[model samples]
Target: MQKHALPETVGKNIKTKLMLSATPLRRLSQATATAALGLTMLTAIGTDPAKAVNLKTFNISGNFASTALDGSIGLPVNLANGSFNGAYTVDVDQLPASNSFVNLTSWNVNLVNENTVLGTLSNSLAGNTAYIQENKLAFSDAGLLTNENKNLYSLELDFDSNFTGTGITNDGKFLDNSDLGSVKSSGLTAVTFVKIEPVPEPQNLAGTAVIATIGLWLRRKQKG
Candidate 1:
């Protein structure tokens, strides 16, 4: 379901300037067609307590400005147009204590396909509470992981750990009447990074107030 809205400002400055990576092979834009993420390898990041960090959002975007559908090879995503967005948040607390994939309350992506195929889909996307995990994030249609193949329009996005330097690594499948005829399914990809932090607690003004009151009382006593 929809959660926090993705931040619109995440990758504003770098949109057109991001040159496509120099990957040599060509890629197809179809849902079934998988592309290599990039020279940086994507590995499954396990639950490491030492590396755990607070829940944060990631805004992912890139201009597909190269020929042959060239772009960064990050992980797959939920069959999504919304799920695959510029602003995506995830919670990565240390395991056993508690952890989850924060539902994206809102979604927006800045994808300019300078070339072609495989990008964000429609709003039919949804997520599962069970898919939440330590150092991981995931989303799909309304049901379990297995049901993705059956939906009329569906997509999936899985992130190993958004806290890393390369940004959110994603893997996913997508299906729409346009991509697969009547077949139901989903996937898209983006690799930019942004995080949301809790607002700081208001300064401890109560103590200052009490001190001021005492000082006033002392002054009054001296005057008397």
Candidate 2:
């Protein structure tokens, strides 16, 4: 068996633990004695690729003012005026370009008022137009060089403007990102633009957060 660097106290414990499976130590090179102790730590470092973040499911959550738009719509819960949770999957294991807009393969979001999940809206049903987009570059509209910029730290989601389907309220209205979240001068938004982001992996012993992005964007949902 191979031995790696480990502290003296832990090395002794390993020596006792691995005795039945391995040979007894004939001599101590100080480093050779360190065997069996660092197996757990070494296995973790060697198998990093297998543990990399392949970010498959996205969990979305956000709040709306108590006086937003759902009141007049007659939803069971005031989702437009309160908070809700939604999620989506692109079926692919990657993200879109920082400046590109692409449709999601499927999505599911709760049509929740302040305290109730009236229903869940999903792509399995009709009118599920979910997409992700970001604007990392500043564009010059008519050569004026607009100073506006979308966040590079977080990704945002938008459904079709007021997509009405199974979740439509009594008045025949649904709550979505109604093309209102404009982070740039170009003016683009939906019923709501809730930020999407990857919950960062806990820092390693070296204090480094290993964030493996599939494409780009989707780091954290901090608006710029």
Candidate 3:
């Protein structure tokens, strides 16, 4: 039997289609490998102990009448331990005589997730000052400040009267002065809380952008 060759146009079209089809598959494989490698690098960075530690600082400020209060909390973090030393300072300045003569009855710091309290500052303070007071709290446990556990966290303070005066109250997280029979301070009280997270390094940001671009390209390829 004699063999016949296909038409030139048909042969060319078939070759073109094959090449076009193989091009996407090859690119897709490369993209997938790049994405996987990027993710692996990120994971290693997260788990590496030698990397530079990052700390997130949250500053909270509150004011009532003439009293102005500032609070700062710091959490030291790294990938391997995911644990850190937690330190906080609460300062009360420009306190009015009524609220100035107040003692920190019980102060509590919580790692909160929505309505749940994940961790707390176990240390306590008493009789630290005569009328006005400043409290510095620290915890050695590395588990208290891990982002792996919760999405949100907060520090709360409770106060009591050191002298006979109108009850000290806060518009923010401060609770009512249960020791004194006065209601929580109403009006002219405001509190603000701010959280600051460390900025990622340039190399890490570039890696993130690469991963994001790969994801977007994959999505577009699938749509096509």
Best by lDDT: 2
Query: Candidate 3's residue-wise lDDT over 2-56, tens digit each?
Result: 9999999999999999999999999999999999999999898886576442222
Give one digit per residue, the lDDT tens place, for model 2 in 49-134.
65333344455565544453422323322444655466655433334334555456556676566477755656665433455444
Alpha carbon deviation, residue 112, candidate 1 (Å): 6.5
**Model 1 Cα displacement at 92 (Å)?**
7.5
Which residues of candidate 1, in runs, are more than 4 Å off?
Answer: 1-57, 62-85, 90-101, 109-132, 142-149, 152-224
- How far does residue 74 in candidate 2 sit from its true spot (Å)? 2.5
Please report the TM-score between candidate 3 and the true structure: 0.23
Among these predicted structures, which one has the highest TM-score? 2
Write the number of the candidate with greater TM-score, choosing between 1 and 2: 2
* Global CA lDDT computed for model 2: 0.42
Question: Which is the winner by TM-score between candidate 2 and candidate 3?
Answer: 2
